[model samples]
Target chain A: MARPMGSVRLKKTNPATLAVGVALCIFIIYFLIGPSTSDFSASRKATAAAHHLSPPTSPFRKPTGDKQKPPPVAHYNLNNVTTTPNPLENRENILLLTPMARFYQEYWDNILRLEYPHELITLGFILPRTKEGNDATRELQKRIALTQNQGPEKDRFKSIIILREDIDPPLTSQDEKERHKMENQKARRAAMAKARNSLLYSTLGPATSWILWLDADVVETPPTIIQDLASHDQAITVPNCFQRYWNEEKNEMDERPYDFNNWQDSPTALDLAKKMDPDDILLEGYAEMATFRTLMAYMSRENGRLHEEMPLDGVGGAALLVKADVHRDGAMFPPFAFYNLIETEGFAKMSKRLGWQPVGLPNYKVYHYNE
Target chain B: MARPMGSVRLKKTNPATLAVGVALCIFIIYFLIGPSTSDFSASRKATAAAHHLSPPTSPFRKPTGDKQKPPPVAHYNLNNVTTTPNPLENRENILLLTPMARFYQEYWDNILRLEYPHELITLGFILPRTKEGNDATRELQKRIALTQNQGPEKDRFKSIIILREDIDPPLTSQDEKERHKMENQKARRAAMAKARNSLLYSTLGPATSWILWLDADVVETPPTIIQDLASHDQAITVPNCFQRYWNEEKNEMDERPYDFNNWQDSPTALDLAKKMDPDDILLEGYAEMATFRTLMAYMSRENGRLHEEMPLDGVGGAALLVKADVHRDGAMFPPFAFYNLIETEGFAKMSKRLGWQPVGLPNYKVYHYNE
Candidate 1:
């Protein structure tokens, strides 16, 4: 009888214990509920702005009778015309981009984002889309703002988006049929269309005077590259794009021959060579013929003129440029989506044709990671 | 009076002493007679051989005259209708005689006369004579001997010979004011003549395949050079004849690029080449390009059909070869002594006109010194 009464009393509630429990529950609810509402609201605003980021258009300060003015261009000589908010100083700049490899594998943000005292126009991309396994190449593929900066990465930027074969694309022929070989090749051709088309290049604003396009793997510094893109009123050039590749001969990656030691014993790949000039390189054995490394760069099908024995059409594209408002009648690269070392040929040819010199400047250098 | 008488006696009264002295003198004369006669005869024979050595012609040994005669050539076979002696074992066996730059230096005695077991049919020589203070280039000369003995030092025979202008034969200048200059130039040209017009080459015998004439300042060594030269059975080829010039920047001479690094940035000196190929190398970089090295030893200049450009006018005399007994239809080298490096071209024109070939062997790997 005594035990039964004690159990009953114990089951009943204790006043002091209930009060403490209520206070703890209340504090937990307040802490959790307060921060969440604000965080959600901020995330919604950020998403909305990204979605609203639209390409700009020129406003109408002139009557409908007047012809549409050329898009903002990097123009000089202020006395010729007048307008508010000079595009060269305040407008956004656009750059057409490509991948560093057969695919994209890098972070690119704010490559041409107009910031800091200047406005950016747009970012053009040359993407290779839709490919499957074994069709993939070593290249950079994606473009994204850095997680740390919310804008651009330290040095890498995808000024132009370079899309390669589709990631995880379906394999059409899994039965190991040889007939699929032709289909595989067809897919490759289609993937490169974005880069080959000229429509993308023609879109650069008329107001833009300096157009720069870097590989997807390239990075940018200071978030904005507007100030860095400015150039003198002459042909623009850059030193060789630096890169690091594995060499099988020495069984290691080496900088001695390519990045160091200076190329020696190489042949002059050109047909019109002269005796070694007094100012030319110093060397030991001609057996190695290393000097031809540069000539190989020049005589390539992509970098130079269509000489009788040579078919090269351009130069390297690792880091390339052109004056936006340059008055040359034709200033476009060949309409080929892919070329072997022919990017710089376009600049070299146009320069030669126009009697303007395209000289590589010592100070103009780029460290390209040519994996 | 006594002194005068004594002096007269000393002069006149020596009959008894004279008889004794005469007898002693007669004995000595008798003792030396055999050796003195032998020395006189030997000297006369040597002088005659030096000035008037000629090939032995076998009229009775002609195949038509003898039913059983030794084959026209020993070890003759269709497989080797023509052959080039090995460079090592046959260094002196196959002679290349040319007055490139080493011929002018004065030597107390010539090595060819000392080392060889056989009478050296040394056929090439730079002409004219020289003394002190004539032509500032006098000191830049050497002596070379191309002989029948194959040996290491056989190639040391190339040298510049400064011809003596003040000779009875006379060297008239086309320009009176430039007589001295013209004379100096004439000497060099004459040296070239010794190479192009030599009887020894004519007598290498009809069975012989080629004659290689090299310049003085070249550098080379390899045990297999002879085998390599013999390997290329073409009608005309030149052993390597690289040209070396001072590079101001590197402060040393370097071989021109062959791999195209700078697109023929440096050229081979024109004088360095003696090509028999139909192509016009003049339009290319013959100035410092290494493609023109003097390693030639090929078919005689009788292969008229081999050359087209400049028509095998004849090959440069620097490093040349000819098919033995292939009658020459081409003109010989120019009457002038030397025109920088034009000797090869001069001979080529002559060969082309006459329908012969002047071949070069690029594999011979000969390097000329840097002046």
Candidate 2:
């Protein structure tokens, strides 16, 4: 400092200057290590919603006098689920959904097909709709109620009999650019809603603790898969997909493994709206899996909840299992008003909201045939 | 004819025809009841040179010129050996060849690459060629001699030794199109011949009861490979080779086992000529393996050796072990004016003269590099 040494001066400091410098250093450290060090912002969700949410529009369309009738659906949230834990605990509940098609043969040909660990998988069946004509045919409606009235097996875990009357007719999106990109998502959602509706309005409805869905094409389902799943409380998915790669294609019948890359990519509403044609459908859309772990990840800021999204592009629907309470608290799968692509996507949405994660095990695969 | 009933007439058979017919009836019964089944054809030698071979016509040929210049090798037949069995025979006197190679480092980075009933597998060294360059150049002649001298670890059960000089090499060929297909054949033969020559002339000149030629690339070369070979007093090849059309380009690595299809188009020659280049050079072109059991197959019609030639292409040398007497009795590698093409072919030629049949092992696949 004596010779004004070109900004590299070593000078004696006063008490005030020293104090100021220390304060500045502390500020710099705080600024550098702040954001990544904590999840305080994410944790304070209540305040963010208040400040972030957009204003809602006019409810009931401003009480139009022309409203002589109410909406046909009496339920609010459409998912309407009963939230109550069953009094009978430790029953080792199991849920199996038997869609109308191919159910009889599947039951005779399958069901106790092989051995499994004791008390691991309990079976349940859900009767699918016979017809989805305009206002839901009476005969089909009668079948839904009759099947629900039949009740569950003696050893069955499904105390809550889910009745499914409303079914979406098959409609192929003809978007040449968008393929089966969104099949898993849309199908899963609709299926989930149908299952929830039936379960919610059953005699032993509240007693039900678990629900399982199986694909109709499955020829031989391995029992050990369920046993392994039951071993862990963590949300999981048994590996159920396979692909044909450049090298793996050469594998003999005995050498084949489940492939993943060949999954159907479900599209989103925005993309579908542009061009809704099956031929135009592109196989690039995706959906999230209905899993407790995944839901938790989505709720939290970390876990990379937005990663590759396994099982989302297309949930097999061939097999799925879920807890009853999970649906009640999560509001369950909502009925789709405008589209039939709800079964797969609806379940994923509900599971995510309920804070469940999904996992796929490699040793498990479902044998099935598809046209 | 007594009556023209569909031109049928009662006629007495000629005495010769009657005998033949009786024999044929007996043969049919014997065939039907004998439980005719093929055993592990490890005893049969394939087509080798036919008998009554014409000696080389060259003016400088051995017998016509100088008998002292190491007369051309003599063929082995049952009439040449002592028929009386030696009761003193303890463990089959065996020869073991274990050669070290560059890429084979994984076998023995440590522990001497030992994997076996140690009594089997007499580990040997790779052959070395003469060097002509500077200090960087290793002398090939010196190296080959040194390698043979050092040989495999000395062991009691495997007193018989195998060296690279056992094989004969050639210089040229009459057909170029056919010659290019061999794998390092030229150099390998030269080294093999030199190895045999050096061993035969060395202090341990007399081969033990048996000699073995082991291929280095063989993995999982079970002790049984050696034990199995030793069990037979006669020469044998575990994995006898057969002409196989392996389209390396197909499926890259989905190679099926060698079978009849590939061999159907192969040449017809004495297992000897099959083993040698037409110019009498060493060539390992045949499809199968040959051992002392091989010699037994060719032992002779009167000697009780009735092994029919299966026409195998080559014999694996991974654990080749042959009786010393077989070599001592003037049995030796065929002369190769050019390069050796097939080893099994060479062994097959020697085998036929010795009345041996080369047989193939269906299940024995000595560890070999697929790449």
Candidate 3:
């Protein structure tokens, strides 16, 4: 009786023929699969190199992958991200990030008036999925379409990405009075921090050299604001945010401090932070939660000293610019209380912890819309 | 000496064992390769379905692929592409296309002032590679980023796409006198036809129900222009284009007819077309090449009739709205002369050949930029 191929006796089989068959099969499998496996591994490594350099505190870091290891040093050295004397010749890309809840035409006009080369600017916007957020998004999109589709090529932005993601419960009202209520500060600021981080991570491409966190309500920035801010060339720089409001008693428009978050931490503020609950957040510009810190807003003079810079313990989102390496080093807005601070304030603490100095321009002012 | 495995005769081999070995080898090969081939074929069919329904006249059609066969029937039936009475509630997407060489702030302002639900509008632009074109693109991009980043969500556009591709030789001067020269007419119009076609093909998504061919120079369209033109619900509709100019002689602003391309094809015009060379193009509003056709521009009265529709043989591009299926069915602007007409007029001729009627709103005015 004939035996099956698998059951053939080793003594009866020709060892030389069996060896040749096995070698041919192995060669064919390698020929068919080697290139594909190599390509797959290469792409996996590239992805890890791009996104896996997360800090210990990053919520985005993978739980199962290298969590105990320290983050790798950033590819972009902080020393190399200095400001250029002439930005017109500089080709480095700047990412303009905005967290929007309301749309204002005046704010859009100010952005359009910036004299920086639009081709080097990439815009990223994150808006909540609420009714007001949807309304703002629609208006913003219409304006974008008009400018992008009709403008000169050199003045066009490199790219614009809008993300609609809600990180907080929908607010019943966007009224300033309702928004400023002391009880809503922690939740509101934490939601905003999440939005900012979301925009940063999703839009921070490899080409980004700087990040400009300009609030959507910042309506009256100088046309040379980008050049002015970039010329400082600091690790992190923030301009004083002010608003022109009608002083009814004076019967004239008067400028007032807008963002109180740009401040120098005082001994009293540190003591208050220590006494607060672990989950409690510290907020600026409120009488009930007075930190009594020296504010950049209060340091403004009549004529505005353009080159004046001061080291800050906390920063404001309004017209703040930072080198990309600072972010790549794993500094982001904290959505939860970190040392009794959250959001933009927490971001300053995190940046300092990562060895980046946050500086404030006391007299370089960007105006917020007075509504 | 032992014989090799291949040299073993059929009588010496076990037929059942050989059959089992052959079947196992075939199954392994199929297991490794079957899914990939099926996926590849599916994607290829999808691509062919999306792009292969081109007419015989399309210059974009592949020369070697099924040239003799008629184009497949369009998936979007023209009869079903009618405009809704209420666009506010309509979910249909409208693509706004423009061919730009310059950017004007007033033109951008007019687009922003439009009262349509911005979320339903997608803007598309094509520009030349010339210096002026670059300048226009830059300025336009600045405006787009501002609006898109700051506007209310409900008022924003669905999307915006800008394509920078030059089809014509760069013009040394953009002066009206230099541009209007009869010698430059054919090349200029042919290049424009190519730009228009490029923008249309690149931006026409499957969801686009309507296409509004708005010129970048048309600076005074009504806020409800989209709703107004869409209410007509025709396959193709064009509003009369007029320019408001300072009448030094009359000492006031006077409205003058701008687009002369919207006209009824007279017998004299057909005779003129027959005598012209195959590559020659027919231009409107010039006394030198008068075709003696009745123009839609001349049909306007002192008070201006808003709802008056006039059937026409040729159409102007300024504020022209068309159903998307008319374009999908192969009606594109001809870069070459078709009936001695090129660009917008050739598009009208092509539309008629494809059985879509071209209609002009005699007094529904869309003002062109005076400059």
Candidate 4:
């Protein structure tokens, strides 16, 4: 009887179960080697509190009751020297830029929750010329319709503009040695830079005072993020990006550094950066010690001891805010290495060369999608 | 000395005083002959009551407390049979159309005061390709910007579209004989019809359920006007046109009939309508008895007794409500006579031929600007 039953069912392996087993294995492997999770401890918290001595309230804050106290004065160093009073209540015309891959419902939901006024914000997007992009746009339109029905009196965005670009050229060879081929990387970066420049020049009107580069993959951020960045009053600023990863063993989620490109330049690193051929890209993680720079994500020692305003040699596009005037003043995302960097990082270098200070917030972190 | 000075001044014949005297004489003559003011009397009031029967609360009313009673039911005659119903609560998509001539601050203020949900309405404009139209658009933009800044959270219109069309070809000749010239009238009517049709077709989306044609010069109306019209549930309906005029004798404002196009057809009128050549024009006021029809504006008999709902052979476009589906089903403003009528009158005939009922509210009035 047992033999007959086994022959009827167990004799052949179930394909679905086999596939699940393979998937589980791949998932585990990916987490094990992909990135290091941020370690948390009591001492780190104390240090973080000590390092970030004062955090300014956003300027967009609506006045509360008379009992509400005034915000503490914030001091920001320019050129790592001269201190200036922060412009706390400045009303700026902000232009938001996003290069979308696929539409996510949560992305819009998060945007609607932003603490800033919708009337002052102009949203701009660039979608890839792919079926996915078209589907995303359709989904977004339905979302807008739903929003319209729910609140007939809600204010709409000041303006909305959508653009499309073709996919970047693919690499010709898969060989590991040829994978880092300069031509392929340059082609990909160039396409990205071109797409970004087109969006900026076409949509940034005279009224716009600031330009925010937000990647679609960045799914979660505090609603006060925009106001917080504006409060810093820097020429350029970026927030640290963290990716949330599930710790299967711990039965909880953990955070890992997603973008470690924002860093402070050292003499050796500056030399190495300068030595690179104009066309050569200085890879982030690979050229770490050779470039004599330490990433902001790694530099915060003793828990929260990271400096409040760290000089950034390069900026991550996942979330970067810049003065619109800087862009109008000739700063652009260089596809080929200018100062041994390209794309967003290259843009930061270009801005610096124009005598604009770029700052990074080591303690302020925005989450990126795991994918 | 005073007498001598006065004589010298009077002899000089001041040019400004002469011009003022001439303008006053012209104004007096125009007022005396232009249009007759509606006469008032107790008998007329009784007759108006009898003709109207009942009036209902407008749908545009915002709810108050339990003590606030429902609006009185309105009495309407369909095929000459009386019926009463309260149509105070119905929600549907409405497209507001206006052919603007010049910018008026009061006009925008009145629109903003409309009781309907802004998100449910699409505001569309067709401006003449002239300096006045351009100036109006610029002023409108500034007004919108001001409104946005004052109330950032207010619900904005679902969408706004402003289009420009070359002013219908100016009349070729101003000769009084040529002014009523058939070709000139046809050309002017055709131009207006084309402008209206272009605005309607280009902007009306599938989601739109109704079209409200309101002339920009017709400045003021009850906030609940949209709801009032929708409540009728007729294929086509119009509000009585009242021009607000300053009464020099009374030193107060008075109202008079501005549109008398809505009429009941008589055999003689039908015969007259049939006899007209296709190319011949039916001048609004001039075609009176030739068409054997009684204008509803005059048929009201007494001051207030304008029938609430009247059977009409034609209607005016000052303020017209039409079903979107009717337009989709092929009703249009024919520049040429289809039933010995052109422009809005022709539109009524076209809709009737398509098995739709056209009705008018003679008692309900909306005001027009003096200009």
Alpha carbon lDDT of each predicted model: 0.27, 0.29, 0.59, 0.52
Report the poorest 10 consecutive residues by lDDT, candidate 1 chain A: A24-33
Give the residue spans of candidate 3 off by over 4 A.
A1-371, B1-85, B167-169
Better of 1 and 2 by TM-score: 1
Q: All candidates' TM-scores?
A: 0.27, 0.26, 0.41, 0.39
- In candidate 4, what are the lDDT values of residues B1-371, reduced to their tens digit? 01122222122211111100000000000000000011111011211111110011111122245563322221111111111122223335577877665667766777777777654565666665555556776776566545433333233443445555443233233444444434555655555665565556544432345788887767788888877877787878888877778888999987766765676667866766567764565655542334446665554434664337886778877789887645643456655454567767877876675457788888888776664
DockQ for all models, in order? 0.00, 0.00, 0.01, 0.01
lDDT of 3 at A100: 74
* TM-score of chain A, every prediction, order shown: 0.43, 0.43, 0.76, 0.69
Off by over 4 Å in 2: A1-371, B1-89, B98-103, B106-123, B130-191, B196-207, B240-319, B337-344
lDDT of 4 at A330: 43
Chain B only, TM-score of each candidate = 0.41, 0.43, 0.76, 0.69
Q: Write model 4 residue lDDT over A38-102, tens digit each, in one string.
A: 11110112111000101111111222455533222122211111111222244455678876656
Clashes of each: 154, 147, 38, 7
- Per-prediction interface RMSD? 51.0, 49.4, 27.7, 30.8
Give the docking tier of candidate 2: incorrect
Off by over 4 Å in 4: A1-371, B1-90, B148-155, B167-183, B249-251, B287-292, B301-307
lDDT of 3: 0.59
Ranking by TM-score: 3, 4, 1, 2
